[model samples]
Target: MRTRTTTAALIVAGLLLTLTACGEDDTAAKPSAPPSLTDEQRSSARAAAGLPPEPSTTARYKFLEALNDIDRRIVDGKDDKAVSRGLNQCSSIKRASGDEDKQVELVKQTLSRFTIDTRLPDIATPETGGEILAAVHQNLCPDF
Candidate 1:
């Protein structure tokens, strides 16, 4: 019984040491900065707006790229996981501070390019989605 207890104690100590060692590696590693906007990102958002690049274009572009990745996964007929991932990406951007509404409007405008049949199911809501889109439209095409 003493031998068995010693072995168990060693095992527990080994686990604790292993966990401690693993944590130190992360401490040494630097946290990555957010990605900058690629040329494709700027073009896509601009395409949707039919206007010149805006001030928040880079940050906006990165947000859109994340959502686009989710969208590409969905278009490939991946599964509900892909669709759900897209929804979550949208939610993340909408939830972010500092011009979230503008980002949301960019998303709506991008989706508008797709045919009604090709679009995501109820992509924007009457409140969050519609309001943002309306503001974008009001600025871009106020003649309407």
Candidate 2:
């Protein structure tokens, strides 16, 4: 009886393990790239804002760096570099308007103490890495 019970238990356990293993795939893929915003969408946003269109990523990053400097100034209770940087960031946005351009403006306004608040849509939840991480997430991360 003991032997039969042990065999039954082992067989049931083996079957369950096989079923679980069968459900997963080692070849499961990562997500595909997100869709790019359409040119019409970009054009409409630019028209509404009376701005030009999107600038290069490099220009965007430099502007974001300047904006973050503004935040550091705020934390120090003095609006020094942040104001300058934030305004510079906004200047960079003058030639662009769309999702990406909107994001650029959001960064500028956030650090510039504007009445109209805007934030980037896809910010990764903040951790303790400090300003550099914040900048990278804001500037480099897609849609950040």
Candidate 3:
């Protein structure tokens, strides 16, 4: 009787192990790329997050062109960085809530932070910084 009970226990344990192994999804262990969102979905997401709609491809190209014109170093092999900084500036502008003075200050700070001269302790000059701000506003976040 004891031998029979031990066999039954072993069978139950084996069955449980087999069931647990089968229940696992092999695909779950592998990483998959995220689904691409449609333009409408992206717009809705931006709206829900309180961010302005994304700039058009043409607008982005123009923005990069303007940045390149202002100072090649700003976009030279750093296009992504420049674009990110502009977007951050736009967010700052929104937070400023139409305070022109605050917006200007924020732009200046952003320019200084991004375009600071490595050798010198100086930031971008007022003219260049103003151009950067203008490009960002006109292209990336005109509504803001």
Candidate 4:
């Protein structure tokens, strides 16, 4: 009986020691959260990447205005939606890495997905796709 008790105690102590060691190793190996960038640092990084300044109110307005000029129906009663779409386009553009064809195709796909007019055969043609690409570039990410 005494031998059994000693063996059980030894097993319990070994388990506790193993668990404590694992906890310490896990705490040391865990990564710390990355530091947040200040606005100036963010701007500098953007500039270094040849990206335009972050979109502002004026940029959003210009995006809407350009889209409205292209086809009023594109923004009809959906100004905020259109702006959000345009910003999404800007993100796609940045990812495209100067591939104009991919950029235009992305714009077309995005427009087709978002356009409310289901009756239209095609919401985006090459012409309008190019225009949309240009608009997004000019108004949202000029340097991209």
Candidate 2's C-alpha lDDT? 0.47
Arrange candidates by lDDT, highest first: which order? 3, 4, 2, 1
Per residue, candidate 4 scores C-alpha lDDT tens digits across 1-144 of 999999999999999998888766457666899999999999898666555666788888888899888887778878777766666666677778768777657756655644633534455566776677788778987765
The residue pairs in collision within model 4 are: none
Cα TM-score per model: 0.30, 0.26, 0.63, 0.54
> Count of backbone clashes for each model?
0, 2, 0, 0
Q: Which 10-residue span in candidate 2 carries the lowest summed lDDT? A: 121-130
lDDT of each: 0.46, 0.47, 0.77, 0.73
lDDT of 3 by residue, 1-144 (tens): 999999999999999999999888799788999999998999898776657776778988998998888767788778778787787777776788768888768756766656544422353676667778888888888887
lDDT of 1 by residue, 85-129 (tens): 333334334433267676655555434433212555544333434
Better of 1 and 2 by TM-score: 1
RMSD of 2: 12.5
What is the alpha-carbon RMSD of candidate 1 to the true structure? 14.6
lDDT of 2 by residue, 47-119 (tens): 5654433545574556455444645323343333433443334434444435675654445454334322233
- Tell me which residue pairs clash in candidate 2: 53-96, 70-82
Give candidate 1's total backbone clashes: 0
Worst 10 residues of 1 by lDDT: 135-144
Q: How many clashes show up in model 3?
A: 0
